[model samples]
Target chain A: MKRLWGPASLLAILLVVALMGSLALGEVRLAPSEVLSVLMGRGSDLARTVVLDFRLPRALVGIAVGASLAASGVLMQSFFRNPLASPGLLGVSTGGALGAVAALALGWTANSIFALPLASISGAFLATFAVMALAKREASAEHLLLAGVALNALFGAATSFLLNLTAGRFEVSGQIIFWMLGGLENRTWSHVWMALPGTVLGCMMLLPLGRSMNLLSLGEQGAQSLGVNVRRLQWEIIILSTVLTALATAVGGVIGFVGLVVPHILRLAIGPDHRRLLPLSMIGGAAFVLVCDLITRFLPGELRLGVVTALIGGPFFLWMLRRPS
Target chain B: MIRTERINLGTRLRDVSLHLLKGSLTAVVGPNGAGKSTLLQVLAGLLKAEGAIAWMGDDLNSISFPERGRRLAWVGQDLHADFAFSVRDVVAQGRHAFGDDDEFIDSAMKALDIENLADRSVTRLSGGERRRVFLARALATNAPIHLWDEPTANLDVRHGLDVLQLATKLRNEGRAVLISLHDLRAALCFDQVLVLDRGHLAAAGNPDDVLTPELIHRVFGVKARMGQEMILELP
Candidate 1:
């Protein structure tokens, strides 16, 4: 219990500070107290609009998306027993992108905001399930990764095809490309509402799976002998992780690496007990993305969120691989 | 008791019948590709076969996964600790069906003389130490039946003997223990032995009766002696 307190408190403090920093250090540059006053419902209209209407939802959505992706990453790594496994690398997020793009291309969003998210969720599910089925049929970790690679290409190509089809409609094509690049700029409370339920549900579902996931890390036969229904558990993890990743993608385009890097770092610091790893990665991921978003907002140009994550994550991953384990 | 009738698993294993009894340790011996591991898997209910396998009198298939887990503990030939977890953590996994109890994990580690290594990362342990950790996991399960596939492989003499002695202890405790082995001498000490050849049950019965020199030559295709201690000459 005491062991949890130190890291847990540290992450909580980091998250609060990042949240405050994101709220206070944007274009208007308000103080922490000013942001707090607005959050407590007593600030001027401009302060309320900037802090509550704008930055607060953006930061909250970033936290939710970060937490979701990180949680998904933990699940993927444990499910595959490979530290490198993640929704982004596996084409799951790409599948979600294709879904959102398809919804936009078909003008479904004009009907309702819900249509795009529902489509993205289904798309994520299909991609994840396809990869899982391939993994099962192949029965090799390396092969599963290969399947992910192929699926990623297929999804990317499909997304490209959709973009090409929408080229005549500048508005639709712009939306598609921007979503594919992935960002959280100009996001609103509605986006927070869109992602929060799935993230919460996914975390709740993934939390209990920690023990089963821990057992699974021992290898399939070992886990089965301990009474785990490996196939069923895999399906559960696939559904939850896909849904979470899809929701995040729907709200924030295709933010990468929060899932990949946050869990890997936390595993190194805290060890591989998913019981602790799952929840801690959530807090760490929220802090990580909030900080990353802060960095992106301060940059000279309009850099995409996924680009920043890949820049930071790719090198961190390389350094990790170079480090002696 | 575990009894299988005409169990077949595609071409890898065919027409295999077995009777594994409690209060005894049964040794399964065979050459490579002879289905020794497959037989243990079928009995452990980890693999489905096109035949009836019963635990006591109930159909093994009808028994739920968790129920079977409580009844049987299995240790596979290949041991992997890909993730960094302590030796005690690996052993504690055995208690999944029964829930967390530090005492069982502690005793299991102690029995394998790994109490000192309990806090050490399993991935960092030596091959023999990792084998012991796996064996300790099976022991910690406290299941009525144990199926171990080549449990002594990669173990040194002392640790190898520890595994054999542990099998004997479990048998004495009235649990059924089935061990697949490449070690003929170790198999010779078990109460009963089942010899397999090309997925066929070549021989079965008392080890003393089944492990004849001629049978060893015919089934294993090796010149062997079964005297006070079984000795083999590889081809």
Candidate 2:
């Protein structure tokens, strides 16, 4: 228990620093003091518009997306009893990406701003349920993973078909490509409202399950002997992880690697006690995404947030795979 | 403290019924494919068998998972740790159904002589050390009925003897203990012995009466001469 405090404190400090950096280092580049004054409601209208109206919502959305993805990752890793398991392993992100792409290709976004996210969320749920339906009777981790793999392939192919159909329409194709690459650019309070509440509530629901998840590391039969209803826990893990991944992808597009990388690092830093790992991963994930988003602002080109994270996380993931556990 | 009536699990376990009393040490002995492990799993409620299993007059199936956990503790064969959880954390898992009981966890570790390895990751432990860690976890449960499958499979001779002694001690404390073992010589020390052959209960009674040379030859296909403390096999 004492070992958890150091990492917890470190993650909290990093989150605060990242939040400050995110708010202060945008195109307007306000000083820390100016940012604080604006937060305190004593700055120029332009500063308020930048910090309060624009940057604040974007930062909050970044935190929500990051935390949700990480928490979902923790749940997935625990459920599968494999460190390689991530939220996207269940095809939720691919489904969301397919939905967003289909929405754009079908000219649904011109109808309403809400069309894309709604369609994306619907796609995610459909994919997850399809995997569940295929693997429901046995409900074994291996079965679920195999089903997820099949669904991911199906969704990825559909997404590619949609992209191909829009190739002649450069504007629609470009929009599809940008959304697939993921970003927090031009995010508003509506985005924050869409992602934050579900993220917070879902994480809170996951907190009490930490102990049960820890027992689950012993394998399904072992956990069952320890009083965990393995079937119920499996369902809960699936529902929570899918909801979190769906919400994150709905708001931020197909952000990858945050879910996979953050939990793995936190599990190594602290022991695999889910009670501590779950909350700490949430903080670490938020900090990581905020830091990554901040990098997107300072980059030379129009680099997407997802591209920067992949650039960082992909190499780290490879290094992890190469190293002996 | 356990009673089963005609428990059948596919072809793995045939209709088998037995009664276990508290404060008694019972050993389930069998040859390869005799369903010893399967019977233990059925009693542990890890596998759902046909027919009925009751503990102290309560139906095992009707009990909630948590409630059943509080009453029965099990250590299965082929237990493996894939994650880097500390030995202490793994042992503490035994107390999961009952809440954290540090004293019990510590004592369980001490009983298994693994207190020094408490902070070490179970994934890094040797096979024998991992076996002891899992045993300690089951011990930490403090359940009324204990079931162990091949509890001494990977243990050193001293640790194996220690485990048998611990089982005896648990029985002495008025808890029921059931173990599936291949060591017939060790089974001699148990108060009662159950002989299984091809998912059938061939015999159940006092160890001295059930472990006769004719029965041993019939079930194990080994011509053995039973002595006071050991069984010598003939080529």
Candidate 3:
């Protein structure tokens, strides 16, 4: 228990700071005390509305989405035994994008709030099943990775085709492109509610599987010799990771790098013990996205959340690749 | 005791009928690609095999994989270090079904003289050290039966001897230990030997009886003799 304190506490502190940053530092800057007063129901209407109605939901959504993506990233990397693996790489996020874009183009999102997420969830499951089918045909990790790449390209092409179909309608095309860019801007309590259940469920499902994931790092035959049902575990992990990634994509669009970068950073900071790494990556991921969102909020020209993450994460990834392991 | 009859697995292994008894160490010897690894994998239940396998009069198929895991531990020919995990963590995985037992890990590490490497990342370990780490992991299971495929493939003479000695220790403790080896001299130390040729069980008996020069020459395409020490020479 004591051994967990150093990294866990550090991550906890960072998350709190990022959350506060998300709440206070925005278009209308409020002091920490002003945000606190708003929370206590004592602030003026403008402060209350700005902090409670706008910033709060966006920050909450950012945290939830970030944590979900990061947690799923940990599972993906462990499952594939590839550090480069993340939920986005497997076409799960692309599937969600396609689903949500399809929903928008069909004008189903206007009729009901649940339609987009439901469609996104189905899309995610479809992508995961497609990847699983490829994996079943060939049990090697490299083959599965190649299959994921193919699925990603296929999903990307399908999504672009949907966007092309909506080109005649300026409003729908703009909405699809905005969502694809990915952001916390204009996110509301509905978005938070939409992402909350899947995030919580994905975490619950993934946490207990940490031990099995650790064992899996030894490779399939080694894991089996230790009594792990490799096939079953892979299926469960795929489903849960898809849920997490799909839900986040449904609400926040295709936020990149949160999953890949957060877990990778945490693994380096604290050793790769999934028992600790999984939960810590959740916290670190929430903070990372929140901080990145906060940065985007201050940057001129209303930068997309995905652009901000790629701008920072792309270089870091390259540097990591160049470094001797 | 483990008994198999006409257990054919894949195109590589066919008609492999053998028995492994408790309180004995069995050495599996074969030329390259002669289905040695496949035989061990079949016995470990990692491969689907046709025909009958019984363990202590109970059908091997009836036992659950986890239950089979509790009874048998296997060390493969390669332990890939694609990720960075501590030596202790690697050994701890062997205790998955049995739960965490620090004493078991400690004793296994001690057996392989890798106690000081408990916290060191496995990726940094030398080939010989990594081989010992894998051996320690298999030993840490404390299973009643052990199947090891070339556990000493990259080890020095001293460490290779250490592996055989550990097998000897496990046999003395009334555990069934099956190991594959390229070293005929090391295989000669085991209580029983099973030799393979082109996926067929060419010989099985006491090492002295089954590992004759003529049999070695026929199976391995090499001239061999067991005098003061076993020797293999090009034909």
Best-performing candidate as measured by TM-score: 2
DockQ for the candidate 3 complex? 0.66
lDDT of 2 at A72: 93
Query: Across residues A1-325, which tens digit of lDDT does each residue of candidate 2 receive?
Result: 6777888898999999999998999779888898899989899888889998888999999999999999999999998888888888989999999998999999999998889988999999999889988987567889999999999999999999999999889999999999999999888898898899999999999999999998887788878887889888888888999999999999899988997899888878787889999999899999999999999988899689999989998998899889887
Identify the CAPRI category of the predicted complex in candidate 2. Answer: medium
Candidates 2 and 3 compared by lDDT, better number: 2
lDDT of 3 at B57: 65
Task: Go through the candidates in order and give each one's DockQ.
Answer: 0.70, 0.69, 0.66
- What is candidate 3's lDDT per residue for A1-325, written digit by digit as tens? 3346788889899999998888899779899999999999899888899998999999999988999999999988888887778888778888888888889888998988788778887788788788878878436778778878999999899989988999889999998898888998888899888888668877987888888888887677888888888778887887788889988888888889888899888777777788888899998998989998988988899888999999988898888789887
Q: What is the lDDT of residue B168 in candidate 3?
A: 91
Give the CA lDDT, 0 to 100, for residue A271 in model 1: 82
For all candidates in order, state the fraction of native interface contacts they contain: 0.75, 0.68, 0.58
Q: CA shift at A32, candidate 3, in angstroms?
A: 1.6
The Cα error of candidate 3 at residue B232, in Å, is 14
At residue A65, give the lDDT of candidate 1: 89
lDDT of 2 at B214: 95
Q: What is the TM-score of chain B alone in each candidate?
A: 0.93, 0.95, 0.93
DockQ of 2: 0.69
CA lDDT of B15 in candidate 1?
93
Best by DockQ: 1
Q: Candidate 2: how large is its RMSD?
A: 2.7
